[model samples]
Target: MSTVLQPGPARRKAARIAVLSGIASVAVALAGCGDSGTPDASQPTPEASAGPSAAAAELVVQDPWVKAADDGMTAVFGVLVNDTTADVTITSVTTDISPVELHEMAMSDGAMVMREKDGGIVVPAGGSHTLEPGGDHIMLMDIARPVQPGDEIALTLTFADGATSEFTAVAKPFAGAEESYDPSTEMDHG
Candidate 1:
C-alpha cells in the first residue's frame, strides 16, 4: 500500500484555519490604531463658523407725543418696550428742545400735583413701561423753538448699558382732553 507522503487532510485544514485567524487578528489591531491618526480631509474643523454669537436687544417706542406748553416748557409721553435679555435704565434724555427731566405726578393735600424726579426710568427685560400725561413723563424745558401739530422732535434716550435709542415725538393735542373737560366726570372736576 502506498503511504501518505504529505500532511494528512485534517492537518492541512488546521493549518489553513490558523493562517486565517492570524490575518483576522492583524486586521483588528490595525483598526484600533486608526483613531490616533490625523483626521480625514473630508471632516470639518472643531470651530463652527456661522451665525451671530450675541444679539443686542431692541427698544420700541409707540405713540410718542409732546403736549404744548407755555414758558418754553412741554411734556413728552410714550410707551417703551424692551425686547431683549438685558435690563434697561433710562440714564439721560437729550432733545433739541432742551435737556429732558423725568417727572412724576402725585397727590398733595388731596390736590393733583407734579414734581421733578432725578432718577430715570427703569425698564425690565421682556417687559414694558409707560410715560404719559398725568403720570411719569419727560419735561422739556427752555425749548429752542415753538412746537406745533405735525412737528417732529428728536429725543435721544440713553440707557445705563451705554445703548441709545433716538425716538421722534409728534406734537399732538393733550390726550383724553374730552374726558378731562367733561363736567359730569370726577376727573373733570379734579
Candidate 2:
C-alpha cells in the first residue's frame, strides 16, 4: 500500500504560525539594538570647549616693572595679554609721570633709535604684545617722583572698545641692560 504525505490544513496552519513567530522575533531583536532613551551614569560627560566668551574682556600683565631712580626718565615693560576675541587698541595711557609717551625702538643705520609713537599698542585677537626695552615700550618722561623698588604705579589703559584696564606696575631697579625684571619683586623702595 502506498501512503501519500500530502500537506494538510493542520500542517499549513502550523507553518504560518512558525513564519509569524520568526518575523516577530526579528522585529524585537532589531528594536533592542537601538537606544533605550535612558541616561547612562557610567559614562563621563563631555567638557566645554575652551575659547573666549561674549561680554568677557580681560588683560593680563606679566613681568610688569618700572625702572627705579629715574634719571629724568623711566621705562615700563610688560606683556599685555588680551584674552578676548576682539581687537584691543590702547587708546590712552596715564601714569604719575608728567609726560607719558609711547615709544618704539627701531634699528636704523645699524643703530638703535627710539621714536615717539602716536597710537598705543594694539593687542590682536587671541594674541599678546610685549612692551619691553629695546622694543615697543612706554616712556615715562619728566618723572615727578623717584620710582624706587616696591613702589606701585597705577597705569590706566583705555581700549577702543570702551573698556579700561588698570594695572599696577611695580618699581624696581634695573637688573641689567638685557635681563628682564621680576614682576613680583619685593624690594624696599624706601
TM values, all candidates: 0.59, 0.59
Clashing pairs in 2: none
Best by TM-score: 2
Error of 1 at 106 (Å): 2.4
Residue 47 in model 1: lDDT? 38
Q: List the residue pairs that clash in candidate 1.
A: none
Clash statistics: count for each candidate:
0, 0
Q: Report residue 182 deviation for candidate 1 (angstroms).
A: 22
* TM-score, candidate number 2: 0.59
Model 2 lDDT, full chain set: 0.69
Off by over 4 Å in 1: 1-57, 108-111, 175-190
RMSD of 2: 17.1
lDDT of each: 0.69, 0.69
